[model samples]
Target: MPDESATLALGAALWPQLPVTGCVYLSGDLGAGKTTLVRGLLRAAGHDGAVRSPTYTLIEPYELVGRQVFHLDLYRLGDPEELEFIGLRELLGQGLLLVEWPAQGRGVLPAPDWTIDLAADGQGRQATLAIQ
Candidate 1:
């Protein structure tokens, strides 16, 4: 994608292709458009509220008309075990999960069904998707 808009468009296109219930890991550095893409997904899924990174909150839950989506940013996680306190297992069984900085969750997080990696490419960005 050449910019955030393009990245968001890609995310909108990818929303319907996503499984009803599964995990997606988003890998990218700060300002890499990870949250922008996630915002795209949420908007496509009928979310009209502001979409913000859960960097400090750790997780944000969105309950749409027909589905539930959880966006997690584990960047500041002190330890993977912290996930246990957040009902991670229960959420995995109920809705779609979009995890950013997934490595921070490591052993505590479930295996993702898809992994999307983003990076800076000049003034634009590059995205790679892997299905597991």
Candidate 2:
């Protein structure tokens, strides 16, 4: 994958492969196209609205796509406990969770069923997938 299109394509391809209700960990550096991939997946899943990074909000909830979906960006997370305050535990096992900066949530978040790691490769980005 050398560009955003490829990343998006990969995301779209994951539409059918992704679990309807489970955890997915997305990790990568800045500009690694993590959110772009999410946007793509959302779009493929029939989301009509914009898919914004939950950088400030910490979490973005998406519904009506046959299941609940939460996109979490913990880059600015002050404490992982904040997730509990936000009712994350209630959302667990109910739908899909696409988590970025997952390392920040460590002990608070549940074990991810899948992990997607993206890295910049100078000319493009390299993506690695881990299935647990």
Candidate 3:
């Protein structure tokens, strides 16, 4: 596992090398810095806007360096059925997706191309990243 900033930077650096058509699922507990990682990614991608969790809205879209980036927080989702109502299918195919609390969506969501798991370790964190 890597440190928080390193993990976020690694993820950002790897962004350009990714498939260019898949999602990245972030599985971890609350306060895990998932959004922080995403903020780093967006900043690396040349975005300067405030990066906030999409907890209440479910998803937030950003246009960065000519690419679309989607950050999703599924913590409030009660069921997978709600995905269709939010037009998930349409937004997914065209952007880089960074999802938090992915277990909440389960079957309704697509298989992730990569997975990032963050856990607290004392004052810092342990981040495990898997690319499949």
Whole-model lDDT per candidate: 0.93, 0.92, 0.83
Per-residue lDDT tens digits for candidate 2, residues 1-132, read: 888999999999997899999999999998899999999889889898999999999889999457888999999988899989989999989899999999999999999999999999878999999999
By TM-score rank, best first, the candidates go 1, 2, 3
TM-score of 3: 0.89
Candidate 3 lDDT tens digits, 1-132: 346677568657866765556789988788878888888788777788799999999999998666788899999999987988998999878987888998888998999999989888875777787899
Residue pairs with clashing backbones, model 1: none
Q: What would you estimate as the lDDT of candidate 2?
A: 0.92
TM-score winner between 1 and 3, please give it.
Answer: 1
TM-score per model over all chains? 0.97, 0.96, 0.89
Off by over 4 Å in 1: none
Deviating ranges (above 4 Å) for candidate 2: none
Residue pairs clashing in model 2 are none
lDDT tens digits, residues 16-130, model 1? Answer: 9988789999999899999999999988888999999999999999998888999999999999999999889889779899999999999989899999999998769999999
Colliding pairs, model 3: none
Total backbone collisions, model 1: 0
TM-score of 1: 0.97
RMSD of each: 0.8, 0.9, 2.0
Candidate 3, overall lDDT? Answer: 0.83
